[model samples]
Target: MPQLAEKVPPSVAGAVLRAVFALPDPVRRLIAGRAVVRDGQRLALDAQLLLLMTRLEGASLTGATVPEARQGLARGQRYINRLPERPVRTRDLAAADGIPARLYEPKGLAEGSPLLVFFHGGGWVIGDIESHDSVCRYLAVNAEVRVLSVDYRLAPEHRFPAAADDALAAYAWAVENAAALGASPEAVAVGGDSAGGNLAAVVGAFADRRPDFALLFYPATDMSVRRRSRELFADGFYLTDADMVWFSDHYCPDVERRTDPKASPLLADDLSGFPATYLVTAGFDPLRDEGEAFGERLREAGVRVAVRRQEDLIHGFANMWGLGGRFQEALAEAAGALRTGLL
Candidate 1:
């Protein structure tokens, strides 16, 4: 729960949030509309929908199966369409290893500007460049950097290594074509939200020639879904326990794959030599603890790191760049981090 002083009143954003909160868990689960009987545990239609909505809203679907996760993302797209427009430049480009991506770059860039290669959050199953378009625009314009938003492959259909492969490819493309994008090769950064953040962290850990920095927003660092925060915020406040199970089921159809370090970077043995990192977590988010834990691990491994907890915020607040006053503050903090890292 947020402190009284940090609480946001019932503004337009707050109203929408409240409306989402007001819906019965059963009703929200029905909205997701994906259900299956697993291990003799059958979820009611409403139950599935509620779980889906919670995970999608809170960004806890890092390991969702591709089709079901895409359904959730479609629901999110409908919601995003209801919001007002912000400034952005959209383009289709070839990423590393010929992966196609729809890039969102903010307008008015000078020659040789810094660049940020961003991946959208969706537990590596849902989300696309379009899903995170608004966030990329806000960061590019406010931070005065070129933002290359990647449309990486998702899980289940694409599965574990696919998203990670695409993320690394995007990072490589950003470094290779920085000049063409009017970006300083030495000032390229990589980042994403939720599962995308996990990809960012993993890529940073393994990049042969690492990026200048990394930006993670409410990242899902542990795919195992056994974190204490998962149980703590499992019910109300957003992102329930059922949602995590759904995502994990989707991302890791094979029960044995859950333990793979590639699926959960928190299980990785090494974290040294990654770029400078800026990790932002929402206090009310289920993934909060794991993101914080990852930051601590990075620091322990001698990586330059900074962790910021948005105490009053909920998950997916980064996409709320046009919503409330706090959005500006969040943007400022993120932009400041990028400036310090890239410049």
Candidate 2:
């Protein structure tokens, strides 16, 4: 049986969400219950409220089948995320290796403007271009750049190395077709969140022609070992340990290959020549420590890197930017960084 939230129309859901968020901070916080503090980091009040709502909805990714999980994610987005804003131009096209892709060009974008080759995150199992349409549109408009969002094949169907191969190929295609896309070939960047972030970093480390910049949102840098953040925030905070295990088991399956540099970018032998990067990590995310550690590794390898920890948020905040609040603020900051980096 569908829960009340699952059955509510998007309009009603959005209205209820807006009404709830419009309440004063104190009132909202009161409704969200007490603050969630761990490792000296406090979760934001709004994030807490969203987390509580997620629990009440009762649609969890942890135990559901692949189709059910995908449906849940898409349905949840309809309920919580706003409709994507229209870009100046949007076109469906095939990326490298005939991968499905979409191009978003912002209003007033000049010739030779920078371009971003974006990969959508879903632990390489569930997300798609539609799932990340809002994110690509937000980046395209806010950064004043063109965005090529690739719909790479997902896992449990197309497993390890498939997503990575598609990401690299799509990036190559973007660089080769940059002029046609109204962007400069030399100014193309690569970016993604979670699994997609891992792919972007992999491209940074191994692409034949490196990207000009990278934008990572709380990436899963290492799948080989569970870090402190994984244990500390394992159960609650939206992305649970069980969910991670499910994703990994489906995406990689073979435990022995988990440490491959392609799977775990943090284990890559050299990052000295990697492109400049701006990586964001959520304070309460299981992937937080590994993402920050990857930044440290990049720095040690003489690569320019900026690691920003959104200390009051949870995992998947990047996908929640449509809801406004801190999520938008964080993504806006990344857009500014992308603009500056590509200049």
Q: Provide the global lDDT of candidate 1 against the true structure.
A: 0.71
Q: Where's the lowest-lDDT run of ten residues in candidate 2? A: 79-88
What TM-score should be assigned to candidate 2? 0.97
Against the unseen true structure, what C-alpha lDDT does each candidate score?
0.71, 0.89
Clash count for each candidate, listed in order shown: 12, 0
Candidate 2, residue 294: the lDDT equals: 98
- How would you encode candidate 1's per-residue C-alpha lDDT over 1-343 as one tens digit per residue? 5322123232443456446545776765555455544323343333333344455444333223455456545544434332324466778888887787765556556779898888888766677877776677778877778888888876667877788888887888789898987778989898888888988887887777788899999888877657766765666544556766766676677777766766777777988877889999876668888999999998999999999987655566676554334555675698789877887
Q: What TM-score would each prediction reach against the true structure?
A: 0.77, 0.97
Deviation (Å) of 30 in candidate 2: 1.5
Q: What lDDT tens digits, residue by residue, belong to model 2 across residues 5-36?
A: 66888678777877888799999988899888
Say which candidate scores most in lDDT: 2
